[model samples]
Target: MNERHEHLGRLLTDAATRLGPGPPWLVLGTVPLDRPTAGSDAVAGGDELRRWVRRHVDVWPAPIGIAAEPPELHPDRTVFTPPGRPAGTYYCELHATGSALGAVQVGTLKESPSDGGEVWAIGEGALAWLTIALLRLLTSYAAHATGWGGAGVEARIIPAAGEGPVVPMEVWNHDGGAYGRAGVRRLATAGTARRTVDLASCLSPALTATARPLVLDLLRRFGLSESRHIDPAGVLRRSHFTGHDELIRTWADTIGVPSAP
Candidate 1:
């Protein structure tokens, strides 16, 4: 792998480490396996992609199992596992064929006991970490291919359940520094709101500052208050964000991190 690929891999690893461990998480993507035509640009693209996947696979955490799916599976096809009381899946679907890129879908799912608020928080953290990794990968890819990054890029988080109004948030990319949006389609549901908060926490510091008031405004609109005294880092360390508030808060605040709002 080249320096750019290696650097991106490190960023992904760092984010995963921050998230720690929770329910089994998986990272899946598609890469061309066929050899490229000799003396064609496809050759270079194929090589770059292969190297990138290699680095990512190498650094994947040992605890989280990798989910292997058939290449023919449609990107839009939903994969649901047996419901776990507080389990969820965070996924990022990237479409790339030949030398062109396509639309991306970044989302999360909460299994059984849909009212399980803790699942939403943990799942949102997973989504944010994955989204950041994807952003870094895209940023690097853009830089290497076009000598520029953060062009023609925008992102928004919508309710995974497709049950409510859509809230759109702007996305920015600055050499992979920080940029993204987190919104929800419905506010009436606690699960949806929790996911929305999870998504918002993934924003760049500047964007987060701009988005905070707006997010807080949305919470009030739903008669919901910002969930405080919950330890996001502890959610990473354990299965839920309820206990160990002081320690998690100390570590997060000292580190300038907040769980939601």
Candidate 2:
């Protein structure tokens, strides 16, 4: 592994340990703002956001909301610990648009430690659901955002915070508004080496020895989301976050994964 890949492995492994027996999904993205939107209200997970997330992201802490201040040094976050399912807590930070804490590089090739401030650690959720949700969230933020950033969006699927198969992917915002300005900022995978297991794993004597990069590549089949982000689809449909159940179900075929019965 190169220095950069090795570095991200460490950062993600540590995050996994902190959020462990975890193989949680981490979705990272940013948008420029006219001004920071910090306040005493739901600066990040405001009611509109809550409704949007609930519809798109399964297993979201249904009442996700953020107080504009601490509990968390992070400016905006909503935390949830289900009754006895402590390991299944839903921890997310959308750092108020202008907060310094929100400034992160999203698994940049430079190898940064500036996350933890922006890591939204979901102790429980499905990868497909999270992937769909990330696209939904990024599209909304991009459509509404006042400006743009160099780094567009990144998503990582980590099998173990200790060490295991990891898959990372990124795409850029082309027009600043939405898709296909230059061309749809298509999703592409990135990692220290494309052979992720070749790098390392903390799993066991067996599993890590023979692991796959993860199902995230399936996300690329949709090109991170052409049906959802681009048109041919209508403007109302393109900008809206609904109408993605088919996408989620197409990629999600869970095994031993619990579901509401």
lDDT of 1 by residue, 1-261 (tens): 243334333333332332212332323222222222333232132334445533443332222211222122344222212233222333322233221121123333332232333222222333333333333333333333333212222222332233344332221111123222222322322221111122223223332232333333333433434412222232222222223334433433432334342
Worst 10 residues of 2 by lDDT: 98-107
> lDDT of each structure?
0.29, 0.30
Residue-level lDDT of model 2, residues 154-256, one tens digit each, is 3454332335344323332223343221112222323211222211111122211122222234334324433223223111121222334343233223211
Candidate 1 similarity to native, TM-score? 0.32
Which candidate leads the pack in TM-score? 2
Q: Which stretches of candidate 2 lie over 4 Å from their true place?
A: 1-18, 24-26, 31-52, 55-90, 98-129, 138-151, 162-261
